[model samples]
Target: ALALYVNHRVRVPGTADIVYWLADEWDGKGIFLQDADALVYPYENLKKVCEHINEKLPFVERIAVYATAADVLRRTPEELAELKRLKLGIIYMGLESGDNEVLKRVRKGITAEEMIRAGKMMKNAGIRSSVMVILGLGGSELSERHARETIRVLNEMDPDYVGALTLLFTEGTPIADDYKNGRFHPISEFESLKELLSMVEGSDFTDCFFSSMHASNYLPLRGRLPAEKERMIRQLKTVIEKADQTLLRPESYRRL
Candidate 1:
């Protein structure tokens, strides 16, 4: 997570040393770098981190981290392959929203096509790609467009996993400021569920696991795409039709 007071990206010094120390202490099979964008580290440094971990802790089977579309694109094919060889197994990337205008508004810095390319790149390099899209990101204005385009992009990417998160306005963020000024409107909890429903219904994936099981979401859903798609869709429709607050996650429980 970014520090509340500092806006710019901050790279912790000796990240590899830290990971090595943690792995040595914990002796776990996996190491997940929970930084905002682990791939943002320079390629040589990233490789060294992996190499150091493998050399020091051969029992560690895999390494994972959060990444961005830009981060994936910045690495060369050779570098990605090398990382995969070093057991850099999976990456979680936030697609946020697929509507171009909505993406521009949020300053995601990459088009939907670019995001798809990045995902495909990771998959081609034998790295599992888990893509996340934010529900209600377009607010009430572009909700439908956001869902439709996001489904389209997900279909194109055919990622190994898809995680759906609902939009939450932090107090100090620009979106929250817009909400306070009435410049932006957030969709209701039920509306967010509807958006998630559209994504589950419209998505066409080959053996992909799709879910809205994040803490930020009102409804929690998880299933293999295409196979359990109908079951998941029916579940969402049932919840929406009932519209019972008791049936959904309470606001107090939701968080970023």
Candidate 2:
């Protein structure tokens, strides 16, 4: 993929690093920003970098900046005003499983209260945000909280987009280690689908774009919420109930 993606005709230096790209500074030394989420960058700094780049050759047809796990650590709600000051239009976040216990077990480094504050901060900043969740992070140990608390978080922030990614244990991470050592156990494929469906079963955010279509998920699904969510949930459930272990998402999908 790397060889194929490198275009000789293209002179762009940086492949894809939001921090560098924001500054019109793209170096090839791209480190996959993976520390739960990218919510840590200060909005003021982000906005300054973004505004500077757009001044010359605008790289955006439509402006959309994501701050995944905004509710986790990257930044706090108080810093959202900086985004508007810089004229940013979009913010994306991953509330990746609302269960507090699950978050603790995974060592995500943040709490439910902080997550709520972070989301509200994004909304107040006038930067539209997308909130995501992991369907199977809790597994059997936290099944009840997994479904209940997720809804609780969603109810609070009610982001512009609510997405879901079924948990996929990547290589050598703490979560993966837990899985190997029996310290952590995620839901079975079928149960995961159930958790996903149940978490958003009666969600009030009708306008949020819901996507479970990423490569990491068992079911690649997408739709608007409140209305189609039920049908979408049921459809996913059907697949999980029917398919065997072979139906699981390919482990290779997780690289980081």
Candidate 3:
């Protein structure tokens, strides 16, 4: 069962209350919720909760939900349709990297193939996917491979929205330990920009919005893919040519 908590906040004229909840169990993808169980609410129970919400607060415009690609893949077309019917706009997917080697090293527990299938499933069911990829996830060793592979995956998935965030390490995580032991080498600012440039330049999307405006990113960029591809690449190229540290976000200011 999912627990709901109501926060009285106004974003519109009427009461713009936001209902928040944690899933009874969630599919583990990475360090975040790594051990979470893959449990889903019963349809009847889910519907009843929505009915209760509708009765109590009728002004809510969106209900946000987080799920892994595997979770989305597990959903039947009917279930996905029902979720759309319930007004769930976009499902947040943290696709850390599209490189299979990086994925295995990180223990993501799902494959690029699964992500592609899941993304298509959402589109077929009239649901939108907002997928995110980590910029330095493949580290220095596989930076180029990461970017190219990510482009490959995104081209196939063709997500409605794509987010690019640079990797941020916490002290105790496995990846952090790897870094400490010299097993993993973090990419430099220029290298990260190179990867980002390659990703945007290589990707071929059918009308999708791409952004690297996350705080962790050294350079922030947002534009429509393919259409604004040249513009974005030019901007990256300018910064790359300048090689100005002032043009990039400082390491001290970067965060998760």
TM-score of each model, paired residue for residue? 0.88, 0.72, 0.82
Instruction: Locate the minimum summed-lDDT window of 10 residues in model 3.
Output: 24-33
Q: Ten consecutive residues with minimal summed lDDT in candidate 2?
A: 1-10
For model 3, how does the per-residue alpha-carbon lDDT over 60-174 read when each residue is reduced to its tens digit? 4554556888777767888778766765556778788889999999999999989899889988877778899999999989988989898899899998899999999999999
Superposed by TM-score, candidate 3 places the C-alpha of residue 18 at a distance from the truth, in angstroms, of: 11
Full-model lDDT, candidate 3:
0.79
How many clashing residue pairs are found in candidate 1? 0
The sequence of per-residue lDDT tens digits that candidate 2 reaches over residues 87-110 is: 556666667777778888877767
> Which one wins on TM-score?
1
Q: Give me the displacement of residue 172 in model 2, in angstroms.
A: 2.3
Runs of candidate 1 exceeding 4 Å displacement: 1-27
